[model samples]
Target: MARMKKNFITSLFDTKGKSQDTEEGLTKIISDFFSSIFSSSNPSELDILKASKGIKSRMTGIMSEALGSQYSAEEVKDAIFGLSPTKAPGPDGFHAIFFQKAWG
Candidate 1:
């Protein structure tokens, strides 16, 4: 006989010091936590330009042109199909096989 598998969050507290244990409450708490982390704090455009100026570019004219060049549909398909089908899924929860199979 297999042992019972127990997986769950017993409780979670929100910023208000309130305890949340229900599914909806827990989902809201978790969603809010991640949202806060990814939410961007608007920065000034001048600040961005100033910071970018400090960075040095190593790319040559030829390299820059090659990187900026547009790819043909056949090239794009080849690049995607070149990836190993059995590799792990990407951050988007999709494996290369997904793209290969979905390619039209």
Candidate 2:
């Protein structure tokens, strides 16, 4: 029989019987929650690329904050271009430039 693994959050709140540290439990709980949300609905390549552009912009800001310098426009462009796309978005609520252009 294969043993079932409890989700990170489940384990964290499982006060029923367990000895987990506060930080470890909380970190897993937080990570699991965000991972679940991000993984919930996979978007398309273009949609993901558009979203990644936003994320890369934020990352550049964080990098600039830590390094005390803003990224050059070219650097930002390169960073955004470096990001790869996710799988095709499913039928419902799926939107992509390629799909629209191709179908239209």
Please write out the lDDT profile of model 2 over residues 1-104, one tens digit for every residue.
Answer: 23444433333553344545588776776687688877847557887677767553445667668788666867755554444434455475454433444442
Clashes of each: 0, 0
Query: How many Å off is the CA of 82 in candidate 1?
Result: 4.6
The window of 10 residues in a row where model 2 has the poorest summed lDDT is: 1-10
Query: Once superposed on the true structure, which residue ranges of model 1 sit more than 4 Å away at CA?
Result: 1-8, 40-42, 72-104
Error of 1 at 58 (Å): 3.2
Clashing pairs in 2: none
